[model samples]
Target chain A: MDGITVLIISNNIVLEKDIEMSADSKEKQLIKKAKMGDENSFESLILGCQGRAYNIALQYLKNEDDALDALQESFIKIFRSLKTFNGDSKFDTWVYRIVVNTCNDMLRKNNSRKNTDSIYWNDGEKEAVLEIPDSSNAPEDLYDKKEKRDHILSCLEKLNPEQKEIIILRDIHGFTYEEISEILNCSIGTVKSRINRSRLRLRETLLEQS
Target chain B: MKCDKTREMLSLYIDKMLDDNLKKEIEEHISTCNLCKKEYDDIMEIVTHLNEVEMVSVPKSFEHRLKNALQHERSKISDSKIIAISDKKKNKLRMLTSIAAIFAVGLISVGLYQDIIGGVTDQLDGTAQLAQDQVMQERVMNNETESDLYNSKLYKSNLDEAIDEKQKFEIKLDVADDVQSSDALKPRMSIYGYTDDNSEPGSTKALVPENYVDNPSVDGDSDGYSKDYSTMMTSEEFSRALTIQAIERNVAAVQFYKGLIEDNLRDFNYEILESDFVQAGECRFRIYIFNSKEGYVFNEEIIAIGKDGEIEFIYTNEFMGL
Candidate 1:
């Protein structure tokens, strides 16, 4: 029984490894075809990742139009830069890196375009930073799940872009420290420290809002 | 460790990133220290709330919109390439025309003015007409070649043919041990039980498993398929009938989906898992597996065979607000 159990475990391990290897190769094949200008293959390549990619953009940009624009622009950049992709990292990671960069660029451009003289919150501000809600009247217990979630999202939006991104990738999406490092093009140590700082900031914001 | 030091390391501790000794030290400190423990709890609570936030679904028109953008990009690339190729020809033509003009000037300078001027003018006119015809002919040829390229290497059909030649279906019903419920947190709309009345408008009505329940409300009759679909057929029988009906209507789409799966998961064999006829279209289900004997659900790709017989990715169990 012990021998049979061992054999079964080993077989499962082998099976999993085989699946992983095949999946990686399949992506590589798609990348190669896309590089050679097979438009359909390129479409197939982005199809699986596009949903998550768009979500990431939405989280960063915080609007449907901006998110969709960023996604479209990112895919176009990916399509153009297919040849430059060295296969040093996961294709999904590379796509994500482009997306993050594009979103950051757009945000910067928009900020510059909508420059204001005052140092305080400008056009994009949802509400006053310290304008605490009437929590005494409607206590925390009264707020439903959706209201709580909305409150959290609103607080999340208050953080700096980098902090918001770190929280989004680490806490929300559940990407590993290593994966976050690759996507953000930062060190794993930086990812760790950044995650801690971001979480602390979020906690502070949540506390303030309540 | 001091409270400040412990506080700094608490996030990493929650994430389980520190080495064994450091982790043990942090744990020991947090146990004794109230301030550090409170800090740890706050961060952990924030992390928990963040994790509970659901993933956003792409807009309904995103895929369609992106495809158009990709096509536009492809045309741009083709147009640029065409321009590059014509640049060399254009340069050569410019040089030849310049030479002709220079020769005409030389003739005029030699005082053969009226005698050769008319002939020269006629020759230049003829050359201009020829160049115009050549440009038109090249454009037509280029278009024909482009169409031929598209027709011959129509990627989906090519993939289908290739897979059909090299592969055979290695499908099985064996569920893997690691097949956890993907939608455990959300209320599920299974054939057995649907606890939530807040089902989104135009979302999937029901996801029939092996033991399909015949609930008229869950049957998706309102979406305008045959009313008796769920009552009459088992999931497999229904899928088979739908596949046949879909093939009869749109053979290319069936082939396209087959190729897509094969392309998506190359050597990873998949089986047609549980399928349902839902929402005016046949919902085809597929799962990747390890082997016939000891297979598990690696990925469950639910494809909706559309009203036009095109394969659309349903992705989630429900469409989730399109």
Candidate 2:
């Protein structure tokens, strides 16, 4: 059993690395073609990046509609202003900047419409206190996983937009601290600090729920 | 290391961001301290769980919408190109029209000057007396007389054949009567004078038509009449009197022509010069004039006619000051 598990783990690691190498090469080629005004290349690039970008927006906005709006705006800006990009950073980092800017703009507009009131997450406490439902031994395990996923999202919502963004990029999106630094235009230390603080808060909330 | 230092390095150590030296020290501390080790394990578990959460799936239509947006942008760029082309065509047409107007003015002025000179020569020869009577009789026979010669189609048409022969005869008779009357009554002070300031006591009243009452200078004295007049007279009366005076005084015709130019040119600064070319079919002298001011500079031509036909000049003024 241990030997089977080890083989599966190694295979999974190799597959993940292959996927990463293929995606990186594909993205670079698409970016080059897009810079030459190839719309198809740009569209493909957007398709590749949309999942991660949408996830980041979803984390910040919580509302599916707002997240979609932010995602659309970010894509439009990325395509329209692609020519101005000097490619000093990775394409993903540049795209992240556009996404972050779009989200910030939406947040500002939302704040103005809400009469500048502070945003607070009332559901976080409730989510932390909510009991996890149990089923039979096997069902209970699956249910627990699902409950934990929901609880994490709820905790993410409780975080301020900045903290939520860092956590999503660093933890959920699997971006390195250096890449996050380029995207956010901050120091690696700052990225590390924010991720650490966000992770600590999320853990505390999870513990409270348990 | 202190607990705070250990705790700080724990997050970095878990993320594998710490250098080897720091990672080694933090790992050594975690091994020795149970409390710190437990905290480190909990943090690691939470980080690992967070990393394991699935990324949200994007909607399928996102690609379609993005493609449509790019296509829409291209269409807008093409539309602006069309607008730019149309604007260029409009500018070309405007330039052509301005050139045509300048040429037409030059031709008309020359025609008037020729007519004026021919009339004066015939009068000097005394052979025109018989022709003048015949012209008067012809004018009475034709029913084509207009109340206001300014609006007469005979005057507007460049073709001499278009003139109503009967109206021409009447004009000849009127001119003959005016010349004789002016010769007989030369004692009265010359009533017409030009002045720079309309407010000057002796300045002639403005010649604006009744339809132009809304004009700023129309109500010069606010006496209900549309324009200021030298003699307190209605526009029609003033126009008739001026016409009669222009016929009586051989020089009055030239003055009337200049008055027309001066009145119209108030809105533009211009210079008038006599052209050496003889007008084709008129007794009036042709003069070239142009608005010389920036933004108003345009080619213009004018014709000045003297009743005895001795005075005539034709000139053309280009858009530039000349």
Candidate 3:
């Protein structure tokens, strides 16, 4: 029985690796075609990464419209400058970097014209930006899960942008430290320390919110 | 390791990023230290919850909007490329013009500029005017009377106003040398047929009707030079001149011939996206007709008009990506 279990585990690892290799090769093919001005290839290339990109934008901006704007702008910048992408880093890392930079630029631009009327800021100085979900109509287990999720997300908003960016990149998006380093254009050591500090800051925010 | 050091490396410990010895040491410290263990547990729980946080999927309209945005960017890049090519050509022309001006000034200093260049220009003008007068005299001799000249079967006009205009135009050129004199100042219609000297009579070629006076400074006017005699032409004559230039030479006039081309293509439902002269003798135009409700270009055609009034398809492509 033990021998059989070991064999199955080893086979599964090989299968996963094969799948990853195929996916990477396919992405490389798409990037090559997209660089040569194939619109369909470009569309296909961004389709896979756009979801996580949108989510990152949404988390940073805390507004759907602003997130969408950032996504559209980032995609355009990516398409226009696609030839400059040398493929040193992963495609998705480059995409996310552009998205993050676009969002940062928008945040800086809108800082002076900040919309104080956001629903996130509606509950006065003490209240968290996002309200806890109305769990009364939901199943007890489901509602509990949702409340915890919302609470954590709201607490995420309370962190500084740097802390929030690192947490979202590491914990939420599941980018490895090396990938995060590439995306953030920092050393592996910096990414590690930043993630550690960001996670600690996030923990403090979550505790304070509860 | 103490509790503080263990806490500092707790996130990395949970991530399994610490080296083997450090991982072992942190694990041992956390096991012995209750405070460090609690901190480690809290951080672990937060990371777990963060990983479990529901991600926002893009709206349904996002891909479509992004594709449109990307298409727009792609078009802008292509337009900039076209502009860059045009600018490069303009820069070369400017450099050549400067060189020619310097050469002309040197000729002026040597007192040979007027004798050589001016004498050639005057001779060319005289020869062109002589050719026009001879053609006019031959037409008068063939008709036998001015009224018969107007009534000749050789002249075909779909519109009555066009016939009246042509008759008035011929009379004006025949009676007045001043009108003929002004021909040098006005735009000269240099017409060429699509068929080359070697090409068979029925074979399709590019019809070019170009204006040399528009850029008379350029010396390399390879457009076949059939001079138009009417100095001050009407818009109707202008249109006919352009169309005849296409039929005569296979090249087109200047950019304003767009309206005339559109009018001629009114029978077809295709919209002219862009029209351009491909070469000295070839006219190439991108035309499209939308088929889908979404308004994507379904059928695209690039066509050139031959001298014999035949339409030659240069390219017929379906499913042009917007």
lDDT of 1 by residue, B1-322 (tens): 7888887877889988889999989989989988788888878867777788888888889889988998898899789768754753564455456546655654554453343435434544554455445545655766656333323323223332222211111001111211233243113423212222365433333332321222222322122222322233333553465466444433433443454444333333457564444454344545534421112123444444433323454563221111
Runs off by more than 4 Å, candidate 1: A1-6, A112-139, A142-146, B88-322
TM-score of each: 0.52, 0.46, 0.53
Lowest-sum lDDT 10-residue window in model 3 chain A = A116-125
What's the distance in Å from true for residue B319, model 1?
Answer: 37
lDDT (CA) for every model shown?
0.62, 0.58, 0.62
lDDT of 3 by residue, B62-86 (tens): 8778767777877897897787557
True contacts kept of 2: 0.43
State residue B180's C-alpha deviation in candidate 3, in Å.
64
Tens digits of per-residue lDDT for model 2, B59-154: 778667766877887688568658755654554454345446645654565565456546544433343345444445545676445333323333
**Candidate 2 wrongly placed segments (more than 4 Å):** A1-29, A112-143, A207-210, B80-322
What's the best-to-worst order under lDDT? 3, 1, 2
**RMSD in Å for all candidates:** 39.1, 22.6, 21.3
**What is the descending DockQ order?**
3, 2, 1
lDDT of 1 by residue, A53-96 (tens): 99899988777899999999999988876655656678888888
TM-score of chain A of 2: 0.70
Candidate 2: interface RMSD equals 16.5
DockQ of each candidate, alpha-carbon based: 0.17, 0.19, 0.27
